[model samples]
Target: MRVSQSMKPENAAKKLGILLEAAPESFREGTVTRDELAALQADPPEWLATLRREGPHPKRVVAEKLGISNSGLARSGITDPLTTAEIKALLAAPPEWLVTERATQAAVRAEKVRVAERDKERAARGASDARRSGGGGV
Candidate 1:
């Protein structure tokens, strides 16, 4: 059966081997971004399954090894699943994926700062109201 585009990103990401822990920023912003797996459906189905059997980076290397264009991997609906060891290796030297890691960290920190600011603002508003109400005492 064919998967519909209406499927959620988190679900699609899982099928694509993403292991999403939280909602994506884009999705939270009222956009329906396709998960990596669904986006790859643009490619042929047979090719994607072939890549899954091969391994990670299978699209590029497997295709090269098989004498097919990398694009073929997308059509085949294949996704390279990351092992725990591989995840550890990538985190140890995240520099290889510089742009993404840095941007992710920055976004997280920004969100934290935003939350802190909001909390402070709310506290100030509460204090002002309390003072106006004569400390809520008899």
Candidate 2:
């Protein structure tokens, strides 16, 4: 006998681009098979399509669309999921908080790149020094 592969509802919801809480109770209570998940993505049902088009989007999606971080959304008191219209509205006329948060997020991304580059250089130097030292002993 072979075991069937399945994923939890939360994982399915993430893959489907909808909030787990926003999904129907029936969907929430059941596990999704890989085929079912793929079918849903390939030809989304009304609910999934609506959720993706009009959303109640997850924080990660919202953050990416808004060019900000999840923490920034929380800091701006946006605890609830936002619909597409609401996201567009913000983009059309960004508030002071959104402006500030975008800048902060940009700075954070830049710093991360800088740190990664520095770490890479350090690692390369260490490798070079190791090669020169010839394993330190015979």
Candidate 3:
């Protein structure tokens, strides 16, 4: 259930066997952005926008306390202001898209297994019936 880059943190967490709850510190002023994201990643404004649109919490409350414009923060795409340890807490977090794709693949595999088992059972039953009727010609 790892979340991938394309997956929303919440969605990814669910798949990765991680639980998403209200972060201890709501996104407010003094909240430190993850250094890696701050350094390695830049300008996640679009993600912020998506979060605002999709999130359950109030975007304005989060933005105002953080001293950022609602639109600006929304566009910033900063999902969680997690520290290194907090980020690590997201066990097996894959990018969002990967989790979805992997789940889909697993479902397909399960279906195939089910179909194969059914076919095998049907063949076995048919063979048993043939034997009982003395239908096999030598």
Candidate 4:
């Protein structure tokens, strides 16, 4: 388990199989070590716990957090995780792109729900129609 003292935080996070953007500031502040990296994988610290809770998350997590899809993230050019501070800041003063994406996400969710309900109604109608038309000579 060899580790360089001057290893970049991002590289260290990569070595640890974690996204640096998802890591807490404390984790980024400290120099990464093989032992520490292994320890984090085996047993995480407070910073690690925080990172797990409030993430610079994976693409899936990011999408869910933002209520948007990966395609939205791509369209918005959001390749990195937004920190809690960053998230708050954006919420306080959302950019046009963020606003637009949120609207799109809302519309998408609404459409999906509407489609599901419609499908359910159609299925129910079909079942009732089958029962009504199920006439056979005794």
Write down the TM-score of every candidate.
0.31, 0.85, 0.32, 0.61
Cα error of candidate 4 at position 7, Å: 26
Enumerate clash totals for all models, in the order shown: 7, 0, 17, 1
Please provide, for model 3 over 24-138, each residue's C-alpha lDDT reduced to its tens digit, 9 standing for 90 to 100.
2233223233442343135444544444333433444444434345444445564554333332333256445434444555676689999999999999999999999899667
Poorest 10 consecutive residues by lDDT, candidate 2: 129-138
Q: Write the per-residue lDDT of candidate 1 for residues 1-138, one digit (tens) a residue.
A: 864345565555445543333324553343234543445656625544443443343234433433334444344443563444443464466543333434555676689999999999999999999999999587
Off by over 4 Å in 4: 1-45, 135-138
The 10 consecutive residues of candidate 3 with the worst lDDT sum are 23-32
TM-score pick, better of 1 and 3 = 3
lDDT of 2 by residue, 1-138 (tens): 866689999999998878999888988997999888989999988998888888999998898889999999999999888989999999999999999999999999999999999999999999999899996766
The lDDT per prediction is 0.50, 0.92, 0.46, 0.73
lDDT of 1 at 125: 100
Give every collision pair in model 4: 22-56
Candidate 1, run of 10 with poorest lDDT:
58-67
lDDT of 4 by residue, 68-123 (tens): 67788789887776666666677788888878888998999899999999999999
TM-score of 4: 0.61
Highest-scoring model, TM-score: 2
Cα-based lDDT at residue 18, candidate 1: 34
